[model samples]
Target chain A: MRYEVDWSILARPELAALLIDGVRYTMIVAAVSTGVSLVLGTALAIARVSGSGWLRWPAELWVNLARHIPGVFWVLFFYFAFPELLPATWGSALNGWTSFALAAGIVALSVDNATYVSDIVRTGALAIPRGEWEAARCCGLSPWQQWTCCLIPVTLRTVTPPLANRTIHNFKNSSLCMVIAVPELTWATQQIESLTFRGIEATLVATLFYVTVALALGVWARRLERGGYRHWRGAGAVWRRERGELARVDSRR
Target chain B: MVELISVTKRFGERTVLADVSLAVQSGEVAIVCGPSGSGKSTLLRTLNRLETIDAGDIRIDGQSLYRSGLDLRELRAKVGLVFQQCHLFSHLSALANVTMPLVKVKRLGRGEARAQALALFRQFGLERRADAFPDELSGGERQRVAIVRSLALRPKVMLLDEPTSALDWCLRAEVVANVRALASRGIAQLIVTHDLDFACAAGDRFFLLQEGRLREVDNYTLACCAPEALRGLSSVPRGRLQAVAA
Candidate 1:
């Protein structure tokens, strides 16, 4: 197979515009969805651990349903099914909106990723020792304050590896937006392939982009783990030095 | 002052604490001792409403914990708890951990809270370790940091649940000594332990809990002389008593 690839497509002004637009749309969808998923997921996690039957049942059902359902189904549902369920005027406005693709992508990704985020946070929250809760209560922290201060920080640190992995997963899942004609990276590549008959090269370039970003995120996560470990080591050294000094002072006394 | 009145706790069919009643006056050090599974921990936990009671009520400074509409956060601020596991926040520096309650719960400014927390760390001889994380500290050091974090709020009562249980034999003495120093500062303390020596040394008064009920013992002399009296009332098996003694 003698493939004469036209590398000029990369430098074309029209292609450059599409690539820029694709990256912008992709980032906007991912960032908005990440924020929405984190807040909703954290709330779901708290409800699941609340030990109340009402809160637990609904939270579990939401997580299970979201996790089991295919991500593509959510994209289609938000883009199609949801509009029909709304009031006629509102439905038409949403359906006819220019930002419909962006809105649909955000909604689908938020719902799909929120389930995994909530599960990650819940595991971290539950792993905390019962004694920490006692200590928080003893300090007279309001339930809300305790949740925000003591519980959230520890849970976030403990679950960061998984949570960061999920964020990267959501980033890749943005490629799925091409199905709804959102014109992200995959969609841009397809456009190039159809116009220039250079599908393989375009796809290979896109794949490299995804791989590079994902690998960089993985490295950052590893650094965070090492930083936490180093912090623990520093504390131990200081403690020993203090004890030694105390002993010296006592001997002089 | 804290009081537990006819409190009972059950996990499904298993009864952890059964119809227990006790009173802790202001500035008193009450040490609770028993074999494992004797419900000593459950009693201490109930004082701050950490473990909810299935029956009866727990009153802290005249506020009923079991009653609806009580502010649990304000109530918790008045009562401080230290755990045997030294559950310090792994992500936070020691100073940040100590200052957390002061800033978040008490709404103190960061500088003000840090100053207070640093003073607490100094008091516990942990000033140098304030910038260190929990995992970096030794067992004894971690427990001291945990105590400082709990006491930073200036709680009226401190609950020490096996504070030295997680430490090695060598480390246990140092942690117990810090706890004894806290007692001398006139902080009301309730210590739950299986270590007879630690209980005798740290507790101003001892209480033997068996089968969810507590009987006060004036001192270690009485506890040792009438071991049978405690054993007779306790639901714990004889084998566990020998294990505890060993």
Candidate 2:
């Protein structure tokens, strides 16, 4: 038996709608997860650095545990096992909800992505000189103001390229949600294959979507490193120039 | 004015500052100099409460530093500290480095903070370098910017730790002039340094910290004989040094 490719099958109205819905859900999960994980990860990184053991230890434990586990396990666990842990009626209600899989997917993805971001951001924070902290404190800026006005901005700016790359990885990981029947882009491709036996065309389209978006994100990360943006958006560029100039002056002296 | 009333600090079983008493009048420039491990830096840090004392009291402008209900932010804002490395915020332009604290801590409007920062920049001859980042500036430029940043807070007392350590002779002279300018403005200064020339040129009074004890010495003694005398006293314990001085 030979496999015949028919690209026209995707033109069917119902099939097209399913693919459209799949793209929408895929983007929603990716975008929302990225936003949530960036915030949570930054906070977690700060917590791990805080002077109090209460904040630091718990944050350390969470990052360590989440980092070692696989992303698929988190997705499945949240979808299949989490509802069972809730109270009986609530568990049943959660299981009965139509969008439960989508919610679970977002939570699982966010949990997994945040650990990587936390590690990256913490590295940037530590790389800052001890002098910066002393300067801020000596100026009498409150601890909260110090973090917001100085530390967080510097750390996040320094780590933008790696953070952007992680976001791209998380966008691709949205495909993992299909295991729990979340019906994202990959699931739509499979559905099209199953119904009309035109899996090739659908798979090609889905692959193109992933490749195109991922490439765009990669270009953005590069531009951030190179200062391709008009605003003072490239902190890494500025940091490099600063180091280079200082080194040149030191040698002359 | 700044005062350290019998300020004492200990680390584990070792004493870093022992019964050290000193004062700087409103327009005075006091220099503290000593051999390495003699706690010159520790003595400076204690004034800003960067190092808490095991016992003793510190007062800036007649208000006790460690008093209950005293706001540390207020205390720090009143007594500015410039470090040996002049740790300017590398992420900000020199102008922003000064203005940020003004806007954030003093609640100055942005325009007001900019004007104040620019005025200091002009006074220090750093107006041309205001847009430069800390790393982009030379060592002298960076140190001046750091001092200007602290001054923008309008501190009553300024503490400088090894200001001339990283500078050439020309820059050292610039710092001496700067210290004199600060004193004329009535900002009392406590400078920690090993440069005897800088101390003699910039200080109104000189102090020596040896074996954790602070003692005032004349500028001539510090500049001429203090180095040889300090070397001779290195082996003497605190008690023996006190007995010998007596």
The best candidate by DockQ is 1
lDDT of 1 at A183: 80
| All candidates: DockQ | 0.46, 0.35
Per-residue lDDT tens digits for candidate 1, residues B1-246, read 778788889878888787777777776778887667888777877777777879988887777887889877777777888877877877567777777678888889866887787667767778767766777798888888888877888787888888766778666777667767767677778888777667766677888777666777777443455556455433334565565477
Worst 10 residues of 1 chain B by lDDT: B229-238
* Candidate 2 C-alpha lDDT tens digits along A135-176: 788899999999887888778668988998899999999999
When superposed on Cα atoms, how far off is each prediction in RMSD? 5.4, 6.4
Best by TM-score: 2
lDDT of 2 at A92: 98
Model 2 residue A195 distance off true place after TM-score fit, in angstroms: 1.8
Model 1 TM-score on a 0 to 1 scale: 0.85
iRMSD, per candidate, in listed order: 5.0, 5.5
